[model samples]
Target chain A: MLKLRWIALFLSLLLGACSQHVVLSDDFPEPIISQLPQPVVVYISPELRRYVHRHEPEQGADWTIVFGSSQEKLFKSVFAGMFEEVSLVFEEKAIPDDALVLTPVMRDFQFSTPGMSKSDYYEVWIKYSLKLARGGGEPMLNWAFTAYGREEKSGRSAAGAMREASRRAMRDAAAAIVLNFMKQPAAKKLFSVAPAAKAERT
Target chain B: MRCWPAAFALLLTAILGGCVSSSVEQLRQAPVGVLKEGETIVVLGRRQNFRHQTEADFTRCVQNTLTRKKLPVKAEQDFMDEMFPWFQPRMAPTTAEALAKRLQEPAIADRLKQTGTRYIVWLDGITRRGEDGGSLSCSVGAGGGACLGLLWWEDDAEYEAVIWDMQTLKSMGKIAVEASGTSYVPAVIIPIPLVAPTQSAACRGVANQIGEFLTKAIQ
Candidate 1:
């Protein structure tokens, strides 16, 4: 009887062990790490706000801005200096109407540029989308520019220089837009736009 | 004689249990092909209409998060021939063999070499379905008592997936995720049960959830 009881206990323990999920905590496969350092959060500048306000006011103030497409980082850096108080918001409705509605058109603009390829332009678009989506509640701005150049020695068309120039121009344009918006009373008015009763009281 | 029978039954259960346990272990131990540092990971997005946008957005969102986490990733346009091969019934067997070889070929191998990538991740599917409580029940019998239990009792949007690795040409993992979001109108209205305020907002919620999952796995 003693021997039988011991056997039953062992069997029960074995069954219990088998029934429970065997999670291997330590033997996990090592994760693959990339060589490039993770990409930085390139800030958008106040200039983009100014440019958008100037170029497209209806969509500028209420718009959620997306940064990057080469020009994205530069725009962020420039705009960081401009906004007196800038807070990143992840609100979905905060996204700009243009980004949601005009993505394809923007992609076309990027592709049509002389030196920039479809893929390169697509990267910019994607990066812009990411910045916008991840912006939390912060405003978004989109800008992309590319140039064309000819090889000096071979007299062949060289796109590298042109692409860089375009990227720079887009960055500058984004910065300019933000700056312009900062200088505009329209921006202040939009923020200060009050209910009719509140306006009357003020 | 009764003892002998009981012993035989116990032995049989042990054998069956061991087999099932080993299979799960094998799945966990399955080798994943290596993707080295600086290697570009190309992800392709496919779906219909607004659904396509959602999937693309999610894919890009994952890619960006991964990149930010320091994974060298590239979103590519051209689909590789080896990755997807065309073969008719008659040529299926031979073509399948050839395709497998092609996947292991030097061209793809060389590109992988360029950045020392040893792993490739492929996202195959995402689906959302309303849960049916009646269909989720299971029965179990113990001693003289039997009972039915319900599985997955929730009001939510769920995503399912099959992910594969390029190097080993094997599936790395499968995941199922569900989330609930509030639906609100312009005015502060009573919220809908589980639907998100907007589809894009739902997509963002899903992306963040997936990001958290990936972070847990990769980190």
Candidate 2:
């Protein structure tokens, strides 16, 4: 009996040593087109540019937490659903005469896991800051939003949970940005006014 | 003795998987100062593109906690409207530096000055349910019915408080609070579930920390 118990322990330990990979995918909620407003150009600052790359395995165990895809691309995908016309860029560009600009900053991202558990879980948190302005006007709005996600160790592979948490956190942040932007009077006023007639129309 | 191996695995898991885990860090400290009696402070949740109930709850929790500590703290009912009347559904300065500059603009500065708000506390964070799985099936025969299955999942909560001194137009400090735990629902013949106190734990922990931090700052 003692020998069998020892063998089981050894096998569990060996299996635990193996590492797994997880990816952070985008999950933006469906949009309400009528509710969404004017087109805006999006710019990402260099500071918020890193893809989620973190590995905090349980003590003496092997597992990795990796976020797949350029975080810049993932961010662009998020805002695409919120605006009628949208453009994303990493490098700074001069604002077009008739365009509104949005600058997003990835303030912080954190991930942590327990050293050991019957079920292994992962936690994620992200902080975001946004600046909005017209082509020539001083920035009218500046704000920050924070979102968090967790993968509870469960039936699916632990990797699935990790991925789910990352996606959810991103979605939460995106949702906050869209909702708050719509609430702003400036946003409302801008969108509320119908666009000018095309030059050719006359 | 024959089941010793299985029991060992269970024991190891329990020992390693601790209960509700949490921590708080002070990113920046409030400058040297003291709030005189009758001075006012306002707690608010940053309005985001979408509504975040946790922000409101956290704002209330912090305000109530601070008030209990003898600090005159309250939440502005129409903070967004009052502070940025011309621009609702608008943007706000994200960094302390940007905010300091924005507040310097005469319109915003005058409005805030009239309110006499000494400190502005912004509460932000998230709490969510993790993945869940399990299946159940039941059949009713001529005589009786039978069922079987199990379901389980985990939950987590994290929050941070950013404090700003209106007069100085600089960040007083920031405190981040976090908590997470697992829960289970099992069924051999019946289902049983263990609930996790993720958000409440974070709330309580953060509230206590803010209280303590303010008390110390006053002394």
The best candidate by lDDT is: 2
Candidate 1: lDDT of B161? 35
Per-model TM-score of chain B: 0.43, 0.72
Per residue, candidate 1 scores C-alpha lDDT tens digits across A83-176 of 3233332233554433311111122222122223422121121112212223234434333332221111122222333333334334333323
lDDT of 2 at B51: 44
> What lDDT does model 2 reach?
0.61
Best by TM-score: 2
Off by over 4 Å in 1: A1-202, B1-35, B47-54, B76-117, B125-157, B186-219
Query: Ten residues in a row with the worst lDDT in model 1 chain A?
Result: A22-31
Cα deviation at B206, candidate 1, in Å, is 7.4
DockQ per model, Cα: 0.01, 0.02
